[model samples]
Target chain A: MQRRFGDQEVDICIVGAGAAGGVLARDLARAGLKVVVLEAGPFWDPQQDFASDELSMQKLGWQETVLVAGNNPLKMGHNNTGRGVGGGTVHFTGVFLRFHESDFRVYSQDGVADDWPISYADLAPYYDRIEREIAVSGPKHFPWGPFAGPYPYPEREPLSANAVVFRQGCEKLGIKSAVTPLAILSAPFDGRPPCINRGFCNQGCLPNAKFSTLIQHIPQAIAAGAEVLPDCTVTQVEVDEKSRRVTGVIFVHDGTEYRQPAKIVILANFVVQMPRLLLNSATPAFPDGLANSSGMVGKGIMPHSSYDVYAKFPEEIRLYKGTPVLATTQDFYETDHTRGFVRGYTLHAHGARPVAMATGISVGAGTWGPQLRRAMLDFNFYARITQVGEVLPSEKNTVTLADEKDDNGLPLPLVTFGYGDNDLKLIDHAVAKMKEILTAAGGKPEFVIPDTAHLMGGCRMGADPRTSVVDQWGRTHDHPNLYLAGAPIFVTGGGVNPTETVMALAARTADHLIQQARRGL
Target chain B: MATKSHYPHYNVLDAAEDWDPHTRKIVEARLLPLESVEHLTTAETKTLYSVVAALIDDDRSEILDYVVKHFDDTLGKRIGESQRKTGVPPQADLIRRTLSGLGKTARDNYGKPFPELTVDEQHTILGQLERGQIPADGIWMNLPQKEAFTKLLSLTVEAYYSHPKIWSEIGHGGPAYPRGYVRTGPGLVDPWEAQREE
Candidate 1:
């Protein structure tokens, strides 16, 4: 039964109805638990709200101010984070990939970054479940990762010119490449039609072809008796004064404050907001923060060193002809000490729209005036390759509360991030490889746009309470009923798209919560 | 003088009718006339217009007016990138102060307003601003010159390329929606896609 805000306590309250929260709400509510979800942004109806224009679709991203510091100040919004019910999934490129076995044991294999509390074997089943649920389409035999063989849906066909060029280059270099595993539907599933090669996946899919939590999990969650409150921003997580267990959450809806009491509270927001909320909810009982026993609420944040290498091809490579990323190679995904970098990166044949291409040239190459205009005029002849280089975790990179307040009268988050020496070395190696691949495919390598994406960590999970905020099952070390169910719990960010892993972790967390409920805890 | 396009035969608006209703509405809104100036003053608006024209290397009044109005709307709504480098003010404040500084720099250095300066002189001042070589005086004090220049350039480029006219010039296929492309193979082209004249 759907429970509303009143004096009675509900079974669960999940904050931020994005990837993780959507899954948790659906699973818990289906099990007969009264669940309520609070989302900070509007609940969009894809057909009514989505547009093909890049400038307008940027509304899907979190537009609140975040103060950035450090040598390489990270650019927030559209590229890295998201707003609204579906979160980043609504605007993401839909590149669904599973982390390799080595990604789980980064410390043991590469001697850098901390090891995940759980192994790949623990997540492999959940990964399989998520791929089937979302109908991920890919090659019959995946070139990388432990689990191989046919995905739930067949691979997308008629490769875009950019993908074909990238594969040709990889083939010439004797490197293995494959059609990228994508959450985008290639065949009709669950009444939704297949992709029509719109090439606006990053601008929010208009045809309902791409899988997002807003269209899939959230609807199922609502049908399963969960009350999903959109445009409701949770300000603080309330805890019991004596027991120290989470009581519920205080949120603002339509300029009115209300409290929803629940037996359990899960923070499913991403890297920046998750820690910001915890630190903001500090009380006298837990002076530092709610889950600050280890003092690791907002430390060790990592963003993959994503850099795009644009090459000019003689042929018309009209990049915006199909999905943004249709093909990728994981040839350099494992550590090779000979390369002077501790970890490796994945290369994708990424597509670019006109505005994105122009901005990339202007910001990345510092090209302006006549030179910038000339580059954009030949935009149709460019094929781009982007690298997702693994960045090592640094305690120096953090998310702290700023003195300035936001529109909600809460302290704004000040995000500090800078690439380490190893991270820079990894980027250099990846860029060289990208240029070599483009050159081998009969293209002249031109601009290398330095950027980053996929923010993770800040509230990591581990077995030790002294060093980690949550346990392997996402339960907070200090509070038994307070859990985190998204990228914030990541111990190590793998060099691939993170949505699949995020959903898989949420599924596992749901199972754990369901088991605890069965025990009447 | 209007900037000459490499692909003059292509016009992306020819296929505008194929776009979905929501997408078409959003794209069409860009071409609508501005009702009034919401963010910048008249002087600031003229300064921004000149700066955008110099940054994009385009002199067409229609394109310049649209770009300036689009930027003004972005500032008024506070929809631009909210993340800022430490110590830098908000985007609106940064842009306003930088425009004022550019005008003052032109008057002090060349004895004229920024818009009245020759194209070559304007380019030189812009280069100095981008390289952080300009002296910090008056409104330029504590200002991040390179960051400000990059922000201005990025915003201008975004607005310039977003125009359907620029899309035609760049041979871009605008807004594929209900009817998406079928010929996606190497060197293949849809009938409505841009074709370069040999």
Candidate 2:
């Protein structure tokens, strides 16, 4: 029951209809281009949004990051993909942020951080368009990263309890703070309802207040004339050597193999598996990978630096019942030469959802009877704050194909990453800030948790083939049409949720691809 | 046994060293996340309502909206504990380790947090509850306690088995939320009505 690519040849064959792929497909198809998207996941069911259930353990939850197996024996297994048509967008906690201007030109400013192939100005408008299209909310007047514009989305959601505390803490500490720009609807606009205050957005939002691709871009693309084939995993790509162009893509459906030819092939599989598809695309002309001639394939992968902090409170405050995150402090976002860390982290703290908070208390508190319940009841009041720091990309921290094979027999990725002193020292500074907030919040006994969750530096972007994988527009130097999105293309991880920047990059890539297509090679 | 939201972290070892060998058997087991709603006893079900009531009273909704907009999944010390419990040192596996998954759902679904709990302790706790042995002490899961562990046989275990609604709720749908189930103690029963096995 394998379905071959529809009889007609499409202008572009895009693999991985996840976040970036799905967005790009809609844009390309709407421009009167016959585009075929081969998604590994099927149409996701909102009814199946079960991350909130008591029965739904983390094991059952869809993964946010790829779990690199093998080499790292101590780490858990599963280099995961957000399975289903919407890919990771369906489950991602909708935090949108543009890499600040300093982020776009880190190497130029401090000479410490790496440089990107393009400047923030080149991608700023795309960021604006994506936010406007997706209805991102933040202050229009405030300076963000390196760019600023009219409020693309109306600011509406009230600051969470922890955000309130974070504000107070910042005020006390005299640090600049503001509500972060986000994809979530604050008050309600664009005919969509406002957030209903359901604390389970990450588990999946049925209300559609959260701007998942399924609710926003994909729907528009469909209305404008685009066909999406779900549960379709593209296994390989075929390129014509003589033409030096992608002939089409070869995929499988229902255990049967099929091929679809197109004038252009777009690999929109984010960073992790995007390379896998290209690497697997073996032909006489390009033996190493579809676009891996520069030998920079799968090099310079950058995940954001993860920031974390935990604190206890005396009152029964019920921290878990509210929105998980709301406001952010950008005081440390740029080239603050005074600081020891190369790149500063963004400060963010908000209410903890009751479910997750209770779980936190239980880790230390006794489990079983009265003690566990009391810990839950007691923790109803405790608060915690954290930050996301941008880490500079070093060649050493990277993701490579491992010797171990997955269930698919494809070599799984083995990631080698560790925090340099710069990151650790920044974390210590961030923790000190966290401690001050906890103390000011009247948390009688506040303590810093430990070091964890700083993601950055891999598959970096730059103009030079020697140092970078993709150009500023995210196009790979080796493959003209293929583009990489998500955190992987980041030359230097910016201190914030990279989703918004990712949206901007994807939008920018779409526009450039159309321009190239019109030129007709 | 309290449900998973009762503890904030779950799933997979971060480092080879974090696991306490004794808790391995307990950690691997998957208990159902739910108790069918209709099966709940009157008091245990009431407890669930009370927790929700308290949450609503605290304006949990307003707070959640804020944090959702600033979401970043990062696990700190809990990851260290995860690695240390298994006696494995931290390595690259650390970055990929997610403490968010390990939250209370695992505890609620399985009724045990530590993976290495001895078989004897497991049986002792289960057998006492099944035999309706209400200890003289209050409850271990409840707060402000002295002889809390002594009351383990009487309150939390009974509520877990008797209240099918709490069990079902934890076993299905969303990640197990915290305080959805009620605590057991004085508000629940009189001494004479207690199912103590003399």
Candidate 3:
């Protein structure tokens, strides 16, 4: 039975309604455990809230004040984070990719980042299960990665002009490229329709063609008896000092503070918020923070080095005519010491809307007035390719508390990040390769825009308690009843999108939690 | 002088009738008249209008008015970027201070208010502001000039490009909803999409 907002204890209390939290809610609720999900943002009905206008659709992003510091101060808005129940999944491009087998044992393979406690074999089944369940559409034979060929759904048809030019370039260079694996449905499944090439996937999908936890897992979780409470900002995770276990979370809804007790607590929020919550929940027993035995609660955060290279072609390439990212090449995804970088990157033919194109040129190239207007005038003649370069973990890159406090009376999170030498070299190589590809396709490579995306790591998972915050199953080192899920626990961010890996890890954690509950642990 | 468009024949509003009702309603709202200025002072509003016009290189009053009003609305609602550079003030504070500081710079250097300055002079000051070469005294003390200028320019560009008139000028297809693209081959265009004249 669902417990009321009081002292009543439930089986589990999950503190976020994003991808990992949604998966945990559905899995655990279906197993007959009472669950309650606390989301800081509203529960949006897509048809009512979603719009095609870029300015208005930006409300889907997390808009709170987070102080950023470092040489490369990260721009934080619609690109990196999200608001509402679905979190970043609501507005993310549906490029679903699994990390390579070598990604799990990076230290052993390349001697850079620490190796994950678990391997690709442990999470392989979960990845397969998620891909089939989500109806990922892709080509029959993926040219790279450990698992190749025969995805659950066939590749999407009628490639966009941007994707066609990308493929032509790769073909001219004798390089392999294929249709990107996407979470967007290509065929009708479970009452949802296929994609219609609306080109507004970044602005919340209105037709239910793209997959989001908001439209998919949360609904299933609700059906399985999980109570989802939206617009509740969790202030702190209350812990019992004597027992050394987390009791529940204290959240504020409509200016009223309420504490809902639970037997187990899960911090499934994003990288910044997860660390902020832990650091703020410091008690007499744990002065540094809860789950800070190794003092790794807010350390080693990584953001993928995503930079765009724009090229001009004689023929018009109306980039906004189809899905944003359709074709990709992982030819440089593996580490090649010969390239002067440790790990490599994945290049995708990315589509750009009018506003994004204009702003990117303005910020990236520092063009204004006549120069900017001239560039926008030739918007149709431009095709863009972006790189997802892997960034190594640095302990200096961290999330710490700021002097300022948010409306909820908690100190604001100050995130610090900077690209290491290897990361910069990787970017330079990818940019040159992208220029080569565009030149080979009979286009003039015009602008190279530097940017970043996909935030991962902070509460890194590892085997040793002294060096890591969480175990392989997402159980924190200090507390038995407390768990951390999602991208926050990523040991080493791979040179690909991190959403698939996040959900797979969450599924594995849910399985462990269910088995433990059955054993009455 | 008017802003010249590469695709002079294209008009994105022609397909507005085909969009979903909700999306159409939101897009059409951008064309509405300015209700009121809720955040900026009268002086700040005037200076901002001049700054946006100079930065975008367009002097049409309607677009400028909408841009200023949208900036004000954003400030009034306190909606801003998720994060900021450490040591930088909040956007509202920075914008307010920068507008006043720009006026001070104009009066001190050009012997005129920001709106009364020549287009070339205005461009020169903007360039200096972007490079953080603006003197740090009075209203500009402890202020990060480049960061403030970038934020203002980004907000202005966003507002200006989001307009349907600008969309047509750039040959953007506006919002495609229930009627999505059918012909998406390389360099292919659907009948409803924008077509550039030779």
Candidate 3's interface RMSD, please?
2.5
Model 2 residue B179 lDDT? 15
DockQ of each: 0.64, 0.05, 0.63
| Candidate 3, superposed: residue stretches over 4 Å from native | A1-6, B1-3
Local accuracy of candidate 2 as per-residue lDDT tens digits, A33-75: 8777777656665644333422222322223223342222112
State residue A47's C-alpha deviation in candidate 3, in Å: 0.5
Candidate 1: residue pairs that collide: none
As for candidate 3, its clashing pairs are: none
Q: Global lDDT for candidate 3?
A: 0.90
RMSD of each: 1.8, 13.5, 1.6
lDDT of each: 0.89, 0.53, 0.90
lDDT of 3 by residue, A73-118 (tens): 8877687788889988899999999999989999999999899999
Query: What 10-residue stretch in candidate 2 chain A is worst by lDDT?
Result: A70-79
Candidate 1 segments exceeding 4 Å error: A1-3, B1-4, B33-35, B78-80
Query: TM-score for every candidate vs. truth?
Result: 0.98, 0.70, 0.98
DockQ of 2: 0.05
* Clashing residue pair totals per candidate (backbone < 3 A): 0, 107, 0
**Judged by DockQ cut-offs, is candidate 2 incorrect, acceptable, medium or high?**
incorrect
